[model samples]
Target: MSSAGSKPALVASSSAASKRQAANSPGGHVDKRGRTQSNDEDDDEGNDTQPVSTRAWLSPILPSRNELITSPDDLATLLATLPGAEARVPDPQLTITRARHSIDSLLDRSETEASITAALERFIEAVRERSTERSRYPIALLAALPGCGKTRMCLEVMDRIVPAFCSQRHIPSLCLFLNFNSDAASTWRSYEESARHPQHAIARRLLQSYYGGAEITTNRDISVNAALSLIRRTEARRQQVLEQRLHIFIAMDGATRLVGAHVAPQFQEPDHAGLSLEQANRRFWKQALTDLQVACRSFTTPTWMLVAGTMSSALKQAVTNSRFFVLPVPLSPLRAVYAARLLDIADPKAPSSRLLPWRVNSKLMARIDQAAGLPRTLLHIIDPTTFLDTRSSVSIDDATLERVVRDGVQGSIMQHDSDFLESEALLIYRKQAPVFHPDISRVERPTTAPANLVMAAMMSTLHKLQGPDPNKAFDLWQSWEAFCAIITNLRILSAIAAHPNSEYVQVTNLFPGSTSSRLPEFFVNASAWRDYSEDNPDRRNQPVDGRVCLTPAGYTGVDSWCTVYVKDNNGEYTPATLALQAKLDQVEDCVPLSTQIEYIEKAQLNCPSSTTIVALLTTARMDKFDPSDVPPNAFILPRQGYKEFVACFELIADNVWAYNPHLSSIPRLASQFYGKGTTLAQARAIAEVVNASQSLDPKKQFRTIRDLRTYLEKHARVPNSGFTIQSIPKDAVLGWPYADDLVMEDSSITR
Candidate 1:
């Protein structure tokens, strides 16, 4: 190849020009630019002189297409002719050995559990001894959830069984690994049409194990059937040659995909008109599995067929019917010791690294185990590369470890498939159910649909909910579950409300106490205001404490005028400042606290002269207060309440239903009562009653109380005694858990 554009032109000397001129004169003429011009007339007349370009003389000789360039010399010559090709040529040995080393490293890096190793060893020994009828074919099924290392386990088994058989029995084992999930076999099938044999591509992979890229005899074509037959024949002939058996181990990873593929409606034929689509799909999968089972049985030698994957119910049933010896190798979360070892293997310095002392702290190890013990989860939590930087001393303290654990758990939950969320959520609920319900079996468990819905809602909330603290995300999850539990019980009550004979009682009856009888407690000390008012009879000149206590109902007074206050941060001991109310729920231009303070100063009510501050408390998550918007001396606490406020309001709403026997039939009412087009006030009222009735069951009541307590402990700012129930926002109250006006109202409540 020409190197004209590949390199800069060199300056020529007079000595080089003379040599070029002398060399060109006999064969051809040289142009001024040092280009060789062939004498066409002389060449056509059969002249011995032949002309070659100056660039051609400098170019390396290349091998022809017909030449077999196997030697290093030939390869070098061929590569040299291509521009910049010499730079691209890697060490031949390294290039050839890379795949082999990678395969070995994969096996070496796999952290095998002792149980897995022992099971494989036992199975292999049984197959060797031919101790049972099942050992004749010796098919073992390994099942696990995804990312739980089923594939790695298969590799580990092969790594052990292959060597053991070879060393002890003096027999060579052929271990074939096929991953159906990844289409490992199908990928090679694409090349079969052009290959000399049906199994040519597969045989090539097989040959790599024995030869490691060294030239092998490939003139003879071998099909898959022929390869298996050859293995049987070779084993029979081994008696005469080495007196050893030829053990053929065929391991299929992701065997579940085989069933999944055939079960998929698109892959099944609809030729049978009598059969439904589902039936036809199942039949196709059954046949495919039967064929695989038969193929495994056909192997006559001491053969081992190992299938591993996330086994579905259908797949498991099919395997059992085939009479395969099922050796369950379930992958568990990695133990701390194994995780540490894996980390060490991934990064040799990880075990000693100060930054990631995962092994040093037992508490950290336990936390990691709880957070993500699976191989994939652990790796994701602290990737090998994360500890690669050695210049700076890195330390994973308790806080950092906690964050990592939280991140890993959150990621695992989020990454889980929606179809599996119900089961995962059930697992979480089961752990807590025993504690909350002593008679867990009797407690009505949530169905898959509701559980999945709750999980989805929680996930959506987590995605949108933002704050500075990472722990808040976890707290949100706890609060969400509590919310879900309460709603679930309420839904159960609605279903129960279909019956007319169900008794309805007051909210206080459940607690059975005079003190806890009321839905919400209100406390106020009016002595200061009363005493001040008596001293100055003129209302305009009297001092007010501004300490009036109001329940949710009291907040919306019969009169248009309402009193509100800004509490002093120093303590509730100092008198509160009176303020003007701008909005309740749906009023426009709801003035900010700062703007309201200005309004209070201008519209002074009948009160003694005193510095007043505007204090507004609502269920809304308010923006951070701007000091510039208010006076410097003003105390403004925004978003004072947590989600507990919503929970409390919901509880009060439930109480409305419990005390009002007439509303007991709300669940049976028509759509108009809770349907779309219903006003916010209407929806809130209906929802509270319906939900309260639903939550009246003894079990439900207990669950609600427990969930409420937990929610309060995590997110509530004040004790139950100090807190007052507030009304829910009109827009927020109409949902599935709450009553929508689209639902019919029961006129029976009026009775």
Candidate 2:
């Protein structure tokens, strides 16, 4: 009996070992004895009795599957369970230290040197004065076009002047740099979260600035109240140093962002519907400004705020309304010498000899200054790595230099970098609009139209007129009349679009008075047309076609004029013949000299004796036309005359859309007219136009005009194929005398 019991025990031990091995294998099972069981045995056990659910093997310290968070609510619940998770506070000392370091870093990166020191000194002077009078804090507003180094100037002032002031006076001073671009509240909140021991945060940031090796710390959660408390503590400490008053220098960059955020609801709301994007942005800016104001006021420290940006009128108003002592300092472009020095510092790796070539040439340096007009822009254009080509032994040529300058300016304008183009276009439009309507002090803003569209339209009009094969040319008188009509129509449409609230009239009803009354003041003046008619009694009776009529001089009178009418692709009439007298240089093919001469001689023959016919030339110099090539009596009016005509148009268009509600649609219009498919072809065209206009070489302008003509031919619509003349009854005195004379001759023959 003992041997049999021993045998069963041995078998049971073997079975247990086998089960344990099976449990350790993949997809194996564990029995109640903590021994592994094979799949076959488990299946057999399942067949014999109900199968038990296996518990997942989990470590005691690890979270169970049920406790795993899958949703935001679950995560929140888990966070809530942690100690001090809800009331995580940021340390104030870290925030102030980081802000100071940021200002320092900006100063360190700046390439500006002695050139910006004047502006820095002014800021320093203002800060020092603030100590003398607690209520008389100087608010210096540094205004400049974008890329003019305003930010760099601010940084340099803070870094050099602030530290120097503190050391000179042996007094404690607080310098705070705020970028209104970032949300003030959220930034503070982030600082609060990231705040740790003040020493550690400061040391870490310093290390990161110096060596880029510091590990980033997590932001500590701090309440708004805690932040305020820190500000209050700093303020109290600042007040204690009354004998050596704590001079506060607060520099605010992009102040436009701050003031715009707090614009009132009335300013934002449109008459038709909810706020537009522009209005919405303004509202946001107004609110942001309010928040910034509140936060700044909360600090009891006597502060001298230095605000800088391209100050908009709205921002200017806000600043004035706030009762801040505004000391406006306008930043101008650096002198060529100063700019060249800056370039040297910006690119230390460049060969000193190679760089000297750019400085020695006064013309080249002047060109560079004109091209960039701003320090930051110049730096961007002449980036050391990209601008300098070490492999090429040849020095830069004038053409290459010219090309670079053109490219830089065009690129800035095309990119709307610093809002340069938009501001320029607006200025041009504003200046031109008031000449047409002297009573109108301000142009209505385009609500639907965009700025680019307006610019493109203006460019397109110029392109058409200046193109190789310009619109049809009528005789001088006829051409002038046609141009007037076209301009008037465009102005009316623009006016209506600009001011939606203004009264509307049909195109036919635009000029309710007589035709002569409808003409612009320049045209109505008899002296303006004295050369064309030469005091002829029957000037109005001149034939519309190239046929000469009997004037006071006679039927073949020398003073008689003939006009050639030309229409543009849009079927708009313009005085193309007015430009006929303009000199043609390499562009003779566009207007053959021989053909023009022949036409002029023919018109002279039909005119009375001593007519002294003249043709207006668009070329800058009349010398382009050889004296021997034309009749002795025929004179050529040079480009200066053409400019005068262009000036007239500019005056009429200035400020027409200054306040247009549809001003935003200009970009879209430009895109539609010049853009290729959905791409940015319009921007390229505009850049090319700007480049051509700024080019010192005249050949580039000619080429640009030719290219523009080709572009318009490919893209613009053809003129409509229809013609109808509508005539209204005119007074007998103003009517054509030739028609009356012909009627009398016919009647005499019948009698």
TM for every model, in the order presented, reads 0.37, 0.37
**66-96 per-residue lDDT for model 1 (tens digits):** 1222222222233335444333321212212
Q: What Cα-based lDDT does every candidate model obtain?
A: 0.33, 0.32
Q: Tell me how far candidate 2 lies from the true structure as C-alpha RMSD in angstroms.
A: 29.0
Query: lDDT by residue for model 2 over 313-392, one digit each (tens)?
Result: 54554554443335565555553334545554554444465343333222233234232234554454345344232112
For candidate 2, the 10 contiguous residues with the lowest summed lDDT are 1-10
Ten-residue stretch with the least lDDT total in model 1: 431-440
Regions of candidate 1 where Cα sits further than 4 Å from its true position: 1-132, 135-137, 181-224, 230-244, 263-292, 295-299, 344-371, 384-751
